[model samples]
Target: MPAPYQPAGVSVGDVPGVAQTAPRPPLREDLNGLRGVAIALVVVFHVWMGRVSGGVDVFLVLTGFFFTASLIRTAQSGGSLNPFTRIGRVLRRLGPPLVLVLVGVAVATALLLPRTRWVDIANQVVSGVFFYANWELAWTSQDYLAADPSVSPLQHLWSVAVQFQFYLVAIVVVFGLAGVLRRSRGVHRASPPPHVYLVLFAGASLVSFVYAADGTSRLQSWNYYDTGARLWEILLGGAVAALFAARHPRPTHERRSSEFRTGRTALAVLGLAAVVACGFLLDGVNEFPGPWALFPVLATIALIAAGPDTSVGHLLRSRFGLWLGSIAFPLYLWHWPLLIFTLAYSGKPSADLATGAAIIAASVVLAMATVRLVEKPLQAPGGSIPRIAITATAAVLAAALVCGSAGWNFYIQRSVSDLQASDELDPFTYPGARELTDGATAPDADVVPALFSAPEDLPVTSVEGCIADFETRDAISCEYGDLSASRTIALAGSSHAEHWVTALDMLGRDRGFRVVTFLKMGCPLTLGTMPMLGESEYPDCLDWTQTVMSEVEQLGPDYVFTTSTRPREGGQGDYTPDFYVNVWNELTSYGIPILAMRDTPWLVKDGVVYRAIDCLADGGSAMSCGMPRGAALDPINPTLASSFRLPTVRPLDLTSALCDGPICPAVVGNVLVYRDEHHLTATYVRTLTSELGREIAASTGWW
Candidate 1:
């Protein structure tokens, strides 16, 4: 990404009108070839396979290799150590393509995405332009519930951000060392030997490796997007670069014997095979940046070492390889947005082979066009962007993106806040679920959570440390609703159960019962092993469930209000898992009566999961965006077939209040039923207060 390896002005023995610059290392054809292959893998796998290829790691290594070598050469020459000149050159090389892509993403987002996603994409743009995309992604991706069709199209810039940050740090460190040497050695020898940098980078790599290994073991989801966890891969490349700089390599390989050439070729072939197989052989998303990442890292190093002697050498120097290398940086920037837009346009979860191929073809065409229109002219010697102009343009683009994104982000956040505050100003105007349970009538009115605010219409536990996130083992609890009342009712389980708090709060306050919550995101209140969160084993969830059960036991609430069952995954009808039954049985043994509520129907159509807010934005009616009852629940309750028949386990189902006839609508009585997919919105849950109160009273005889 560092200026796409700009051709040096006036190489040795070439007659040129340009002034000669400091000597640089000969272009490694093998490295260029490897870059081409890596980019192809990145695109093909992402579009067609739905799997991660370690191509980004390959780029990180190459960035470290090329940048470190260049830094050392500059330092050794006692060159002007001003960092701005160098950074400006890099901007001139990288700025145009980056600005064009950001503009493209902005246009696509405005045209295709729902209002619910506008704030999210704008925040992403602001983060992306300022070169902190990795950190932004880590923060936004923390919630399991938030991962949905709303994935940011600008997400691929995380690698560019990491590399840019490294450039800044690497420049300071290398130049600082050079300055110290100049003072000590009287400016004649301004830099240490290459071995000194080799050792320093090696030490940094080891430290980064330890951090990465520990982080991956602890929480791969967060670590995957962490720059600290990914630094070693790039630093290791710097170590290799320094080692090679110390032992200068020949530009030509003909001086070596035929036997040596054959051996080198064999090693290069083996290394290339490893790079090609790395993604398929290992689960990169779950296991990478850990020790397993060594596979692709070492393979890239091998290609760099092998030089240009084999068929790999010829292929790399070929016209196709050069073309691929020329467009690699822009191609990486272009492919991801194209893929996401394709999915949105088709309204499908993923692209089929034909569709994926078409996307790839489109990406290549766009990449070639970008290289011709945006990259080449600016990077050419006599182009408009002399160093200062490039730097200024980059600053302007970054400011414009930040300003535009902030405008949209502020507008959406304020709008959501206002909607939340006024959602209950007049209950009669938005009667919500009361229209079903109490025959309450009201004039037609707008939904409680307006389309733009729906994504923020979450229950109280979604924030403020009220519930444990997916990563923790701590059983965080909060007291809500009639805290001073003698009788206590515990709300326990995942967000589904946590969402009932709004209604339970009203019931508890009016009926004189305290409501205590035992909640965790995505963790159901069950004795069985919780489902794996993403790809890694969820041992944290396992430990968390036990901690929550113990807390519930100690509280000894009059009745434990919790979700009773889930809609069976990948099949028809709902059923209670044995783990759920075991938890119910154990609570009964503790003399705690159980008020088990059936879960709501998921908003799915055919095989694709759809968000109701997205449907509403696309002009679908409330009932049209809803799910059919038979698709999620049986005609008779599925809980009856389970252990809920036990006297201590009283099943509570209010599907009647949530549904009308056979359909479960996204909005009920002018209130949005769900904030996301299945979790009931706090506003809608509040509307169900009267109906839920009756159920709790009958179950506990508290009334």
Candidate 2:
């Protein structure tokens, strides 16, 4: 349908035949077909795994071979590779279709997505337009792909970026190397042999491949989208092209070279097997572009080396292959965003079988339609449009992508401003007050012991020097509730307990106990110092908590409440028992009665923060947004419950206050509970006061 890829060989009289032992064959349809198959495989794999297709490696090898051959042949014939002409050619090949897809995505995003999603989409649009999305995604991949909900539409550009980077370097280096060689005594010969360039490029590519194989940890850093890790793939193809060019014509019926001959069936089976293995055997989490990646890369090398006259190449170059290959670019571009949008709309993963199938079907149809209607018609010869007109059209599309993304971002921001101002928009209001009193209800998981060795029961630590007074970071003034208040209730722990002040203050008002709070964010009353959020240096939260513990010991509160251990470095954040046991033992030595509240559900849908409004906008009821009691807390942290049996450490659940049955309402008892994704709102804390007011009285044994 399109310009038919211009067929792949140098025309007659384009280059002189070197002193070759064999004739070079014509451009193989089988090889082009193989390219189509490779692109299809990539599309299918990405739709299913949200990962790269091993087939892309195959495409890279083919690109390398074609580009390298062209460069080497021109160099050997004493033709300088004009940089502007080369860049113009590449831009003509890749730029038009890419611009169309990007602008289309921008228009679609503006029409469909909500305000919360626009900021990220706008950032992606800018990076994608400039071809730097690889760096953006590489940073995002650090947390775990499984946790991420939505993948960017332009994520596939990482490879394109890598290829572009390689081409820029290769053009300069190849031309520069030719100049330097011509000046040397060894190179004054009229034409330098093409193998010299091929051998050197191949050698560099191989070295990089070997480096990638040996040190894969770097893949997550720079190697993932780096040209070095990928150079060998292109170099392998280039080597083949160089070999083909330095050949003689064979008499009509005879095969000219031993390397060009192959059993068609064997090549087909071998290539197919290699492709399947890459898809099934490789995992998403492993450092990609690492040693394990050689399976796909080398398999592609094998396929390309087999040649199109062979049975494998012939099959690949069939009508089916050609059609698919022709549409591959558009298909690859459209598939990811379609899948991403589907998953984002559903508020879940599309990894299941049914959804995956649907994604594949939709992607293929869209690719075919776009290729036939837009790409082929516009790019086709004799279309009657001038080159200037075509260039103007491209400019218009580029401008639309920029303006559309900006306009949508502005619209979403305006909506947020307007909504925040309206009294009727109370449904969207984050209940900061209610969240303050609901302390232990926030969901947090425990730190893994392999990353952090939590301390155990100390030998009857005395109260003498243990009690140390410290100034607070926030100016929370200590006021006398009542001079006659004999009973002191200490809230000594992390923000888990600090958030409960609204309820505690109410209890102090209704009951006779004085509420004293000694808490900091994320410290969680742990005995040892661990890495804190944001700050790279070891957080002083533990040191600050130690000071609070000492002062609480001197105050001698009747009841001391703390929370479960949350995430530390190296392990996922989930509640565990060892963390609670460590804290309980430290406070128990001071002869203070302890009350441990189970943490609430940390609502992270698809590794991204989800607000109640996100769910409501998507047609999900407010209750569907919250995690159930059984889902959030695990009876008690497993490590603590298994080893220690403390009578004072009572497990208190206000789950009924947050959820009913398995349905945890985003708004609890008509009050919004959480302010941010995990933490409770200050306003929500006041509402919990009535519910916990009586519970504390009963639990403290001070009725």
lDDT of 2 at 31: 58
**Candidate 2 regions with alpha-carbon error over 4 angstroms:** 1-25, 48-53, 78-80, 142-149, 179-196, 210-215, 218-232, 235-268, 284-287, 343-348, 351-362, 377-387, 406-600, 604-613, 617-622, 636-703
Q: Candidate 2: minimum summed lDDT over ten consecutive residues — where?
A: 450-459
For model 1, residues 1-703, the per-residue Cα lDDT tens digits are 4444442110001112223255655677567667878888888878877677888888889888888887777777667667787776665566667877888898898898876777778887877776788888888763211112445688777788888888787778787788888888787446888899999988998998999888777677778888888889888888987898798555455547787788778878888898899878977888878999999999888888777868877887688887777678878888889888878877777778898888888889988897776655655465455534644665787788889988887888898778667645477888889988989886888877887787787776775568888777898889888999999989988888998988887888888889998888777876765556556666777788889888888888888988888888788778888888888888989999888898888887766677798889878898999989889787876666663466888888999988888899988888889888787888889888888888877777888
What is the TM-score of candidate 2? Answer: 0.64
Query: Against the correct fold, how does model 1 do in TM-score?
Result: 0.91
Instruction: Please report the candidate that would top TM-score against the real structure.
Output: 1
Overlapping backbone residue pairs in candidate 2 total: 39
Scored against the true structure, residue 295 in model 2 reaches a CA lDDT of: 75
lDDT tens digits by residue: candidate 2, 413-454: 565444334322132233322333343342332211100010
Model 1 steric clash total: 0
Q: Residue 32 deviation, candidate 2, in Å?
A: 1.6
Per-residue lDDT of 243 in model 1: 96
